[model samples]
Target: MSVYYFAGASIVAALCIMIVFKIHVDKLKHSPEQMGAILTKFFIGVAFCEVVPILLLVAGFATMQTGLEFNNLLLPLVCIFFSMIIAAVFIFLQTKVDVTQEMRGKVYTFAMIGLSLAISIPFFSLVGLLIQMQ
Candidate 1:
């Protein structure tokens, strides 16, 4: 029921993303041609950072049960632990993306991986939440 965990997750994610953006902006400052690609990646990174928190918040708000389901905290705790770790993973992927031929494939691969994770992790969290409430 604590909002602090969700808020902290968002803050940590935003801070990590801001660092990535700063790095990308400085690196591309000399070549404005590369800015478009970086901006695209930046937006993707932003989405990466936001997905789990929103999903978990929705789950928590919608899925709480009427009884003492306290023993099931472990499931959500694990889900939340891994959810927080995704921020660092996003930073890694964002920093790796570049506007180069060799790096193009890598970017797409990382993006797909990120997208897959963004989908799966929240889904698992929802399942965990539901299990806990039952």
Candidate 2:
């Protein structure tokens, strides 16, 4: 229960943090080219962002700190994989949309929301790992 509780709470916290960051990005009013550029750079950024969380996961595993059965780790691991896939798809598609093809307000907004949520899911495994380590 502690593991699940930590995972769920961390997921919620991460999403909230992402939402805050998205709000700031939304205020920038970037042009379509700018948005596409950001999306391209963002792929690189996500990869870097994942490094620390992954190292934390490795540390936890090495220390045998996870309180759950081995199978229990599978769900969160799969979640992290799927979320990265989703983020990649969104970034790829968004970058492909030219200015003529782009929708102004809601489409970009929705995409950012989705991307942030996808990014946030990895925190589930992260929190689950960190809580056990402590």
Candidate 3:
């Protein structure tokens, strides 16, 4: 149940990032420079809200697994960060095009693809425990 809640919240959080980008893209019509500034703010906001909590969760998981040392946690976290960066570029590129005929459709498609890993990777850790029960 908690995992479901976390997964739902992660999806919502990723949606929020897309929302922020959409809002900035709208602002681009009036002030082009604002897009860059706004995106920088968006990244900072995501770092505080999304990245930090995810890292803390990873740290907590290490504490729970007897053989898992906290010192080794950095590698996975680094991998996730890089993966997010690659995704962020597409998220950023989506903002480049002028507001389109299929804007909502595009937003939904981008959000689903970009956020799948964001939501799935954490929830995936629980899969082993679930599988073991059977």
Which stretches of model 1 miss by more than 4 angstroms?
63-134
Instruction: TM-score for candidate 3, please give it.
Output: 0.38
- lDDT per residue for candidate 1 within 14-98, as digits (tens), equals 4545455555544554455575687677667667766655665565556445443656455445545565466446645564545
lDDT of 1: 0.51
Order of the predicted models by lDDT, top scorer first:
1, 2, 3
Per-residue lDDT tens digits of candidate 2, residues 4-110? 43344334434443443344344333544365555555455445555554555454445545456657665655545555664547443653454233445544564
Q: Is candidate 1 or candidate 2 better by lDDT?
A: 1
**Residue-wise lDDT of candidate 3 within 1-134, one digit each (tens)?**
22233333334444555555555446544455354565566456555556644654454444343333434444443444444554566565765566554455544444454455344444443432232222
Cα lDDT computed for each candidate against the true fold: 0.51, 0.49, 0.47
The worst-scoring run of ten residues by lDDT in candidate 3 lies at: 125-134
Task: Identify the candidate with maximal TM-score.
Answer: 2
